[model samples]
Target: MSRATPPSLPFPPHIHAWPDRSTLLADRELALTELHRHSLGVHRVLLLWLLALAAIIGWSLLVLPVQQFEERDPTGFLLGPVFALLGLASLSPSVIAVVLAVRRDHQIRQLLDAWLALDSAPVSDVRLRSPGLSLFWLLSSLAVAATGLWTSFGTAAGAQAGRSTYADVALDMGIGTILWLTGLIGVVKAVRHYRWALRTLGPVSTAGRR
Candidate 1:
């Protein structure tokens, strides 16, 4: 009689019960890539606004020598420092965004290690745990607008100084308008993206069962 086929071996305890570590790592990697992509777009937009601001500042410097600084609006003079401060404030959101990107990247990489399989975190928890970059942008943009208003005050002051003519005032005001518009657009886009990311990720309530 033919011998009975050998019985099938049982799977190892840990291997059979636990989820695959490699699969979890792969998922985390994909998520990290998407986060980086979105963050890069936001950074690029900010860079454009920054470049435009630099251009305006350069133009202002060039004209200062040729045209008399007219101080027309008394309030405009006071706005000079205010606008400068607001511009400084805008840095906060950008810095936070960078930090958030770094944190996510590091965490994802660590999760890949075989020892600690990446656990599924609730979307709400992830969003809450991560830094809020959008809020920073919103606050900073408000500061930018406030600062621009202050710059207008400075322009008026220049008119009052009677150093520059009507044309100079118009030019300064026009430049201010452009900067404000660009900043506003950037702020709006940033907010929209942040909201979209939050929604797309959705909320995770319970921990991964496996």
Candidate 2:
């Protein structure tokens, strides 16, 4: 009798292959390394951005003589609101980074445990994308845009009242516009990076393995 060929596996055979423990471990390491690399880059950029924003807010407060002006002055009246906007923008990113960091740590621990387990089953799919971060970015972008709109309205009102100079209004509007644009760009980039990561680490099927 002729020997028979083995049955054909499912589509995307490479991904669905039931690899040996060593191969599984190697794949896990590769995935973890890529994740860590991207995570570090994202965290570094966000932290630096937050620090720079804080510095700008501090410098603006120190240099502007808003305190000397009476509360009746439009510039003085707008000072608190403008500072609050900047502070909130800074806080959103900080909170996102912190939450991500904690989740990342937990993920690392789970990955390690999965790799060390004696069972031959494929690892469960991990959630690389964070909904919390996505939500924060979405809300932050809206907040930034809203703040810009408010600044524009205030600038127009001040101009009409002859209390604020054109240069001052232009500067505030420019800053607000920049913040809104940058925040939007960051959200897009971060989301794309996460999606790329998920695709790169192809999900393994646990149908056949124990």
Candidate 3:
């Protein structure tokens, strides 16, 4: 009599197996590399946009007729410069934070090397979190955009009263639109990066817990 054949396994044996240490280390390195590249790219883009905005503001201040702006809405004209200055100043912290992130990543690389060479257990205590650079950019951009919107509204009101021209309102609106779009893009990028980091690194450990 022929014996019945044994049933086949549902999947390959390897499918349910955990990754080896080398594989895990390789994955962690790749993730860190990708994160570094993405963060650097974001930093460069933000810096470029900020510099462009600053240059545009400076050019406008030099070329535009200050007297005409003042006549349109004295309060808005004064507030515009103040808001721009504040926005410019806010970027400083983000720049410093980006630099720090780069340095931290470098340190992490060294730590990874040591762990691999020593064949030690991976450090589960270390965790990565979202950097606040994006939020700062968002807030600063919003402040500048708000200034532009206020200026635009003031100019439009003045025009209705025959005290300002449509051109003034149009200019303010354009600046406001640019600022808002730039800020929105930064915010989206920041949130995306944050989510990506979380996904790549896995869930963070709770405070006071191993």
Candidate 4:
């Protein structure tokens, strides 16, 4: 199908400069770089929630078992549920991150659509990704997924041992499931974005540089 050419229109209020095609692409490449950085930050934040999970689990391990074994102290019993509550509540951020990540992925697709729609778009010299960034995504995602897999089994074991309540198992297993899905999706997205970046943002040819 023949591509529809845009109508000649005056620059909107947001515009001040009329850049050539190459220049516009370069600017867009920079925008994509920033988006990539934002994505990394979001992923990091998502991972940080696990620390809260770990702390809650740690609190439970330290306080609950001792109370049960030693004296059935009501304080420990009370505090245990508090940590569980916090653990469950802390999932809010992970959920937010997931929402943001999903939205950002949509934004990325939209951005790519617009970027490609530009008149005679070509590769840009502006670098969008640093070396090892993709590797970081792959490794970190795999690690998180593995952690999720491990924790899910651990939660099940604890439940079998009667160490955890239904709520505890549910929350713990919920966290694991979220982590597992997020990590796997992250890895896939990293691979995808990396490929797109390479195809559309490679260093410009010498002839094209002129």
Best by lDDT: 4
lDDT of 4 by residue, 1-210 (tens): 111221222233132443554565565555544455555555454554564455445434434444443555667666766655664455555566566656766675555445444433333423444447667777777887888888888888768645555556665776676667757876886787677656655543432552
lDDT string for model 3 (1-210, tens) is: 111221111122231233565664554444444444444345545664765476446434432444345567666566767655664465444445545644654554444333333332325323334355546645665666566567556655666645555445555655655555555545555565466445544455532232
Runs of candidate 4 with Cα error greater than 4 angstroms are 1-26, 40-73, 76-89, 119-131, 154-175, 194-210
lDDT, model 3, position 2: 13
Poorly placed runs, candidate 3 (over 4 Å): 1-31, 34-37, 40-42, 51-128, 206-210
* Candidate 3, number of clashes: 0
lDDT of each: 0.48, 0.48, 0.48, 0.56
* Candidate 2 local lDDT, 115-202, one digit each (tens): 3242333343233334455456555656655665676566666675456654455556545654555455555545654554345433
Order of candidate numbers by TM-score, starting with the best: 4, 1, 3, 2
Tell me model 3's lDDT, rounded to 2 decimals: 0.48
Give the true-structure RMSD of model 1: 15.7
Q: 2 or 4: which has the higher TM-score?
A: 4
Models 1 onward score TM values of 0.44, 0.42, 0.44, 0.56
Model 3: residue 26 alpha-carbon error in angstroms: 6.4
lDDT of 1: 0.48
